[model samples]
Target: MALSTSNRAAPSSYLSLGEVAAELGITDRTVRNYVARGVLPAHRIKGSRLIRVRRSDVDALLQPVPVTDGGDAA
Candidate 1:
């Protein structure tokens, strides 16, 4: 007997907290906490937690912080 393959295609990118953490070089718990704290948005698929952070968001987070002099420059 031969098995049949479905025509469905796999998702391009759906990540769990662990996967997101690995990608961002952070701890899994940090990802979860960020989700909980509403810093990062996440969605639930079926019954598992799925976090889908865009590359832009990651880049924004990785951007260098701006430095301010003690004088009022406005």
Candidate 2:
């Protein structure tokens, strides 16, 4: 049996909790809270305290703000 490898690769990257926090402009503790609350997903390294989150997952967290008419008279 032989393993096969593909020449193509996806643009996926993993980020640490601190990195995720920095990207979101929030505290690392807050990032941990989000993970704990299931708002964000995280993966724990085997036999280590390190945790990793996919960059795409972090991007998914971002949402556009809705604009309101603010009662403007036309």
lDDT values, one for every candidate: 0.58, 0.74
Question: Which pairs of residues collide in model 2?
Answer: none
lDDT of 2 by residue, 1-74 (tens): 11122333323487888999999999999998988888888777555666777798899899666888889688
Worst 10 residues of 1 by lDDT: 1-10
Candidate of highest lDDT: 2
lDDT of 1 by residue, 1-74 (tens): 11122233324444556777887899988887876776666555433333455445455666789987889767
Could you tell me every candidate's TM-score relative to the true structure?
A: 0.54, 0.68
Model 2 vs. true fold: TM: 0.68
lDDT (C-alpha) at residue 5 in model 1: 28
Report the Cα lDDT for candidate 2: 0.74
Decoy 1 TM-score against native? 0.54
Which pairs of residues collide in model 1? none
